[model samples]
Target: MKATTVLAVVCVAACLSIHASALSPFGVGRSQLHKKRWWSSVDVNDLHKYHLDDDPQGYFGYLTQPMDHFDPLINKHFNQRYWVVDKYWKSKSHPVFLYEGEEAELELGEVAYGHHAEMAQAHGALILGLEHRFYGNSTTKEGLLLSELQYLSSQQQLADLAVFRVFAEKKLGMSGTNTWIVIGGSYAGALSAWFRLKYPHLVYGSVASSAPVRAQANFEGYNEVVAASFADPIVFGSEKCVASIRQGFSKIEQMKQAGQLAQIVKDFNTCQDMTDPNDFKTFASDLQGTFMSAAQYNYIEGNSSSIGTLCQQMMVPDPYQALVKMFNPGSTCSDVSFKDFLKLLTDVTFDPGAMSRQWFYQTCTQFGYYQTCDKNTTCMFLPEVDLDYYFAWCKGGYNIPSSDVLEQVNFTNAYYGADNPRGTRVIFVDGTIDPWHALSVLKDLPEGLKSVFMKGTSHCADMAPNDPDAPPALKAGRLEIEKIVSGWLMQAEMEKKHK
Candidate 1:
């Protein structure tokens, strides 16, 4: 492996690993949409939020991709969808910035990040956001089953990006002349950095915000970070909240251990009672999964809003009171029971799993980044999950064998330089507040390549529009990134002239 890759791995020796929904990451829902129903039953409308089509002349298009990118000679094609906007620019002479999409579906989220649109306008650049294959409207001819999902992989998606770049240039009659910069956060951020490295000729630079470049096979640190986020009295609002949560966690553990099934059922509000240890473990994982999901995307500040309406519910001084608030924010009239909570969750969530199967499949096959808890650890969670359970989920959910997942992750780490990514003109950004930030690149890279640490931010905090309340660190980081990208544009032009 490369020296950089080795150093990165050693630093973590271990460690672990989405965004744009408000308080959530993918989309926004109106208070009216839920209709006082518990757990917002996620539907196609909930799949993505529709942005106003008032500016930038955004439109959608499709590209034909091979069924199997690795063996393209014999495979057929599928129409993969993408969207682009080019209205706000100095001129066609500016660099083109590609906002890489994430695992979720998207028409696109609001791209009002601090000065990103301004930078594009100032530089006369074009901006295009490509939906990842198997997401949004992108799909294969055979449709979305494991049989057809075999065509899905980052390698395949990256190739689609390369082809899209070529197609885009030809479509705009600006072939080979425009400098290209790629930007994205979360999984999309990972793609942005990876794309530049793999297709250096096609990309001039990249801004990989909150990217977990390394593929962690055993991602135990995920929940630990979540615990740290809540347990910190300084960052989170109340120590009482933290203490109460801890108490509740202990309560649950004791209940599970002593086979206090009645209390366990009453506490979480499960749809069915689980007596079997294996069944109980699944139940435990689901309950904790809500909390884990919240921390991963807790861009709002304190509280686990992503888990439900957690932070909003956290207004109460007591944790159990807050838990009631979390599980039932709309129903101010009365407390919601745990069983009712299950039914509400089934009806309302866009995906009860908290993620699309496409992403889960990718995680199982390529990433292995589920937030499993550690045994004998006090991370405000139970050790109900590990590689065994995760692999079992993969097998059960996607019908994929777990034989090569770890091997594939190892290969990915080696190939991508793990933390030590090999590239120039790439800026890696991670926030202090985000749990995944630990897996992201924070150290300086060689020369034009660098890292930006956004202090007191969460998830794709940088991806959000200019928030006055945003930390000074985030603002300063944006300025530095802007300078770097501007310099890259100039550099690419100079290199072109020399050539």
Candidate 2:
């Protein structure tokens, strides 16, 4: 079971609708912040506008899934939504590409367009998108109650996929014939690789793009990568850009310590005054997030901002003011209230469409991907936004202790083998500039595994549609993926014939 790893760059061009006074410290709704691609502007009700044709062959549907896949006594079930596109299917014997959904609602646009859809068309395969449990319309009737959310774990989600495979096999008339190739980006990408590792008999291969396979309580490597990206030559980043950012953050910290809160608030256009230490930390987190977002999606097609653009802004005479302007555009008042953020996250009231709370819960219970600044000295963010600052959210939101969060993180890494994942026929793809890549499997393994690391690319850039202006490295990475997938399918066909 040899696998190949690919490091490729991809960009997401989703719009940002951040408010300074939002409940989350990220200065935006947590639901929108965590996804691999942000669909902030795409209304779920009006997704038909993105369809290639009126009533395209791809249709949306739902599957009745158990709320507790491991607990037989629960006997509870929920309808998990999915989208299917069989327009390009050569026959039942052809391959099936399943796009594993992530933290947000599964959009039809995902199944209708993107690299996976293009691959489906090229390979004459069936395409399916399965929304993760507790997201979108895939929720238990009781909603996001703390007790109910206990059922929402990666292990449970993996079981859901296994169950879906069984149902699809019988209903789609492809039992034990068609090969299943799972595909996903970010967290879902981790799932795709884990699925092949856990249930290799079910899925022949997987494409895990920009997947952070490791779970760390304090992800200091994230900011380190961002800082390094600030000096990347491909994006016109220079040492001067990195130095300017560091100096700007140092000035802001000094201002906060010197009791210049009023001046800082006015300069940054914050919605509220920074009276509390928590408030200052929230403000710093917001600034750090702006940089993270830019670096993560730098040069990505359809992106609102890029590293080159950010560097230009940071290199100005007034770096501190330039950083503030980038974060609070149009002189909008940014929210810097940690109390309000805690209140929002602690609210268990379930909105079927909501994502932040659910994602926060997962971070506390399963994967502790807290991008803390205190761990790395080269980090551009203020150290005030440390691990404890994030731990407060988990403790207040779900009463989950920091110790428990660390334990869960350890369990996740141990269970999945972290970056040394034990899987075959899995293509692990990551971009050099993507902070998440630090947690992914970057080195080639001895088990015939391959890793493709694309230089000067953004997060999940290879997952985007084929673009004429895409970097040469990204283009080469995509071709490598296609070739690998083709090889897998061909090998599977040969094995079937021999059997």
TM-score of each: 0.80, 0.90
After best superposition, candidate 2 residue 131: deviation in angstroms? Answer: 0.4
Candidate 1 TM-score, true structure as reference: 0.80
Judging by lDDT against the true structure, name the best candidate: 2
Instruction: Count clashing residue pairs per candidate.
Output: 19, 19
lDDT of each: 0.59, 0.74
Query: Residues 233-319, candidate 1, lDDT per residue (tens digit)?
Result: 434534554556666566667766787877656655544566644455555554454455445544443333343344334435555
**Per-residue lDDT of model 2, residues 1-499, tens digit only:** 0000001111111211121112121223433434434333345664444333334478888889988887799978899988888888899889999988877677776666667777888899998889989988889657688888888998999999999988887878884689899998877888888999999999999998878888888888877898999888777788998999988988988887888879888888887788887777777776776677666666544432377777888898889988777766774577667777776666666576566677778888988777778734578878887888778888888999999999999999999999887768888888887777888888777664557789877667787666566778989999999999999999999999999
Number of the top TM-score candidate: 2
- Give per-model CA RMSD: 8.4, 5.9
**Model 2, CA-based lDDT:** 0.74
Candidate 2 wrongly placed segments (more than 4 Å): 1-28, 31-33, 36-56, 300-305, 330-332
Off by over 4 Å in 1: 1-54, 108-115, 237-241, 299-355, 376-378
